[model samples]
Structure formats: structure tokens, C-alpha cells
Target: MEDEKNRTGPLMIALQYNDLFDLDSISASTNTEDALPKGRAVAFVKAVQTVNERLVEQNKSESLLFEVILIAKECSEEIKMKIVESVKYYGLEIGKFFFFKKEELINTLQSNKVKLFLSTDRDDVCEALHTGIPAALLYEQSDDHVLSQLKVIFSGDVIGFSEDSLDSLSDFGFSETQIETLKAAKICMKEFAVLIGQMKRRFGQENSPLCICVLTAWGSTNVCVSALKTLREWGLDVDEAFCLAGAPCSPILAVIKPHIIWDGGLHNMRDLSAHS
Candidate 1:
């Protein structure tokens, strides 16, 4: 009974689906090199297998859970078969797999005892961290060093490493321009929050309906138009909307109390609102 009290919980690993198979083909199809290269893939497989083998040697194999997450929207049957074959080659079972579209990875993380997410995509790592899961990058140069880092991360002795950190943002493939835009977005978001707070105070209610104003920068006219269409479809009332194109920025900035000020990336906003 005393030994049981000192035992650690099961270890659950969530691997990126594309990382298990041939990365070259997957990259060509997706137009992204965020897939694990052959050498790195073999190394990761060996590392996981080695850990599990050690567990088995110590009579602790029962405390391991492995899973793969399908981040791609569609994969060919042949490609999938190859993935299965590769997992089999590593002696890892293929029964534990989930499609991102069908299920949220956060759900699995919440239910598991100990969770670690591995992926070549920085966006995936960011998402996992956002949901409070420990994640590691499976880069082309991954080796024993990366594996050792994972062990340290899973041990819960680390903190202050977040998606917003410079290293993490860079790993997620954010360019300097993109990072600047995000910083601006954060300031704008805070402004929106303040505006919303003032509106609530004036209305004397927490659920006051807000009049949102959306403006697009010069190159984002098409995105704003799509957002308008989606907003109309959703029956959301928009007080004002416009594309900056050739217009002076001063006029748009002069607007004092728009509850929510959305600028650029309207297409993504539209899709998110539609789904919600």
C-alpha cells in the first residue's frame, strides 16, 4: 500500500498524425515542411519505444498510453496504410488515433493521467500549451537532447515558457511582421475590452448588446467584405463597416466608442463566427 502511494500515474503521449509516416509526401501535399522528416521520425519512434521498453522491463508497461492526432483534413487510404505500417514497425499500436475535426485533443488531455504532445507544427504546440498540455517540437534535427528535454518538461519543474515568448513564437513560424501585427492586435483587444466595460457600466447590465465597428486596412478589403456577409447571415447588427483602401486612417481612428473594433483577418473571423 505504501509503494502504491508513491507510484506515478500513467504516461499519455499524443503524437502528430503526419509525424508517423513519410514526411516528404505529406509536405508536398500540404505545402508545408511541418511534417517530421524520415530520420527524425525514426529517432522519435525509437525514443518512445525505448521508454516503453524500459517501463516493460520494470513491469510498468500498463502505465503507458499512446495516441496520434490527425491534424490534416483528409489523408489518402494508401498514406494511412503506410502510417499504420510505420507504427507497426516501431512496435507501437495504431488503435489509439483521433481526428482533430471529430474530437478535440484537449478532451483527451483532460482525461489522461500524464499528457505530452509531440508535433512538428508550431501552431499545434501553441494550441496544446494554450490548453495546458506539455508539448515538444519534433524538428528535423530531433535527437536524444530533445527527448531529454521532454522528460524535464513532463516532470513539471519548468515554467515561464509560453506560446507568446520570443523563442516559442519563432518556433511557431511567426515572422517579424506577423509578430508585430499580433502585438498590435493585443493592444486593440485591450481597447475593445475597455470599450465594452464602459458600455456595460452605462447600460447597468452585463449582457448589453454591443455595436461593433469593423475596418479593414488597404489590402484587406476582400476579407472585410466576407466578414460583412457572414455577419449579415448570422443576423448580427453591425453599426459600421468599411475598407480603408485609399482613405485616411485618421477618420477611422477618430471613432470614439465602438464596442468591438475588428481590423483585418476578417475571413478567419467570419469562419469562426459561422461555426460558433
Candidate 2:
């Protein structure tokens, strides 16, 4: 009943939980009307726990720099209540909730100072990214794989950078078409890089539940090397860097068992839910 718009404190991670589940499927899967944890919410719950535990152990709990917020588009009261109940059932303690029209999403996120916006809807994620906030389209977790750590993979396209001041990536053996692809991806990755850097500083890279990686089809290309170098200069280096050199990364992704994979194409977020 209280106004949640004015709620402010530590920066937050906003989750658009509406698209995270197939409501019809969930209803069919369960016999009761009570909201049940299904889909990626299960994996997300564990991931959040892992992060919280790491923060507590490192004695960084007090600062509480990042909190979780839940956002959903306006729906019937019945559906809204179901969402609230389901979130609580999953043990994802939300600091605030926003039920707004789709058009208000960016304003809501920016007003709340959300550092990252995550959603199963690709359009929603892309919309958020255009607002200059780091956003990722998450696939549904197909299996109930209990995650001990929140493994993350960033497509090399998103992490790589070719400064205009320097020559284009094409000068470094990349084709003119490939260079065009890089240009399109530049802005989103720049903002995302900063967000990841903050996480590394807060959580401490070694022995942490947050595993960051870069997996690209670029293989061992010169531009790929430059990408890592640029990330290092930004004071952030991925824990693992894989250059598949045009190989289908599905196999590699299955082995890594990442909870979230950020692709430059954005919409191409694979269904990695099958593997842990």
C-alpha cells in the first residue's frame, strides 16, 4: 500500500520475474494455486544465496552495496499476488517491488539506481541496455541444477574493444564485416565491463562464488588478445577466457555450466538450463 518508488539506498539488481516462467506451464506442473519455484528462479535463488554468503564471509555484509529488487509489468491483482507469493516461496528477498507499465521500465530502473537489469524477455533486456544500464537476457533453467557458484560467461564480442583513436579491429586481421559487428556491440559492453569490475572489487576474485568468464568464437585472434588486454587495463580480467575460433560454443558452454551467459547478439542467449 505504501509508495515504493521513493525507496532508495544501496544500488540494486532488478529482476523482471514475470517472463522468467511460463505461467501456463507452471500451473500445469503444479496441482495447487500457490506459487511454486520453477524455471530459472531456482538457479537464481541459489546464485543469490551464494553471493550473499560470500559477502558475509568477507565481512562486507554491512556495506550492503547491492540489493535485489523485483519488477513486473502491471497485471491482474490475482497474477500480481501470485508473483509476490512465488518470489517469497523461492526465498529471493526483494528489497522493493515495482509493478508498472512496460513503457515505464527504464524510468523505474534509473530512478531506483539499478546497476544491472535481468529478464527472460530479450526485448525487455535490450530496452534496458539502451538506457545505459547493464542488462542481460537470461534463459530459463531447464533442469533443477543446484548451483554452488554463480558462473557467468560474457561473449567475446561484448568484452572486446577497438578504440577509434587506434585503428579499427579490421586492421588487426578482422574482416570489414566483423568490424561492423564490433561497432554495434561496443556501447553495451562498455557499461557491462564497469559493472563486472565493481563486482570483482566488492567480492574479491579468489575463492568467490561469482565466476566471470569470456568465451568467444574469435578463437585466438589478435583482436581477442586485444580484448583481454583492454579488460585488464580497465582493472578487470575474466577468471577464464576461451577463444573457440568459430567452433560452436554450445559444447564449451555445457562444460562451463554457467548460470548466465551474455551474448553480443543479446537475443541468442542459449538454453544452458539443461546443464548445471
Candidate 3:
């Protein structure tokens, strides 16, 4: 993956396993481990089911390739469904995940500080692009300039405007309603992932109870509203709540239902990851 050593630039830590296929073997031995919803797991694993056949042509013996394929597929399923699901239940969209052709993505993290994969399309890359310092790569390339790949870059910081900068809003073709929604989210949220880093540095790696408060947007989605209600019931000790979305609405954030929603929320989380 991109150069993870330098903290200044966009660094992606792409974890590729060595010669051990032990995890893969462990997967086939059990069926009770489930952490993600079935749909996500199926979609994730089915992605490369088409390519497994090609493994036969890798010039490796059939027995070796078959074992590798089995292990790979089993590990893939365990991660998307079981691992991600478990973390989601814990109120953290946080975990280690698999990525095909992870080396290419790591290459971007080197000097670019931003991972822009110019080559090697991996099925799992889509998961990688959606998070971690606004990373992305080409899906289908084209000659169009305005609609180029660089568009994926986090240029929102470049405008030096409020979250609702009309010009930036215009770039995405978001309607007036969409712009308002994002603003409400920002107001209620006091910190982002970047802020979380600061806190960790300030406090060090220690665990302590936190006092949280949420401000609701005027037109908050029902899910958001329901979530707040749920938080209160769960003894979150919410200090304050406000309306920023415009009207009384809440979001269905429970879909990513986590046991302990982070103080910063999962709005800018990376993707389906897991622990060892």
C-alpha cells in the first residue's frame, strides 16, 4: 500500500498476508461466526467468484491452487459477514478488511500522501476508496476532463468556505435540500476523525467514560431521532440535543447499528475492516 511510514502524507496501510493460509483453513472449519448482514457478505464474496476459475491457470498445481482458492474464499466470507458484522454491532464501523491488489493502493500512499491507483483493479478496492483520507481510484476511465478521476480528491477543503459553500455544492449537483442536510450534521458534530487523532494525542491511550451531547437538525431523519432516543435510553447521558437538519427528522443510522456509537460518529469511517 501507500507509504504508511510518513504520517504527513496520505498513507494507506495495506495489509497483505505472507505465506500462511492458516486463517483461510480456520474459516471452513466453522459456520457459527457471523458479524455482518447476509446481503453485504454475499455481495462481497460473490465479487470474485468469477475469478476463482482463473486460479487454475496460474501454473501452480491443481491441489495447491484449490487449497489457496478455498482458503481465500473462506477468509473473504469471514471478513465481510462475520468480522464486519461483529464490529458494526459494537457501534464501530472499524475492523481490518481484505483488499485485492492491495499493493497498488499502497503505492499511492508513498509520496502522494494520497492513494490514487493508476493500475490494478481489485474487487475489494471499492471498500478501500470510500474511506481513509478521501481515497479513490479509477473504476472506468474516460477522456473527459471535468469528470476526471481527480474529482475523487477531497477538494472540499480547498474552497475555504462553510460546509454549505454554494459553489462546492453546485459541483455535486446536490439540490438545496441536500445542502441543508449536511449543514445540520456538521453543527451537531463537534469533531471529525482528524479531531479524534488530536484527542488521542492529548489524552494518550487511556480508556475513560465520556460525556456526550447531540444537537438535532430541524429536519433530522427519523432514524437520527430514533437513534437519539435509543441513545438516551441506553444511558448515553446526552448533555444536549439540537435541531439542525431543518425540521424534525431522524436518520436510520441503525442500519450500521453499532453498540457504542463513537463520539465523532461513523460519518467519515473507512470501511468494512476486522481484527485478527
Residue pairs clashing, model 2: 219-245
**Candidate 2: lDDT over CA atoms?**
0.63
> In every candidate, how many clashes are there?
0, 1, 44
Estimate, for each residue in 36-79, the C-alpha lDDT of model 3 and write its tens digit.
32222221122122222332343233221101111112245445
Per-residue lDDT tens digits for candidate 1, residues 26-140, read 5445633232334344455554455445445545434432333333324566555555555565555444554444246566655652245566666655555545455544544
**Where does the lowest 10-residue lDDT sum fall in candidate 1?**
149-158
What CA RMSD would you report for each candidate? 19.8, 7.4, 21.1
- RMSD (CA, Å), candidate 2 to true, equals 7.4
lDDT of every model, 2 decimals: 0.41, 0.63, 0.28
Model 3: CA > 4 A from native:
1-160, 167-172, 192-198, 203-276
Q: Which numbered prediction scores highest in lDDT against the true structure?
A: 2
Model 3, C-alpha of 140: deviation from truth (Å): 19
TM-score per model over all chains? 0.41, 0.76, 0.20
Better of 2 and 3 by TM-score: 2
- Best-to-worst order by lDDT is 2, 1, 3
Ranking by TM-score: 2, 1, 3
Residue 207 displacement (Å), model 2? 3.2
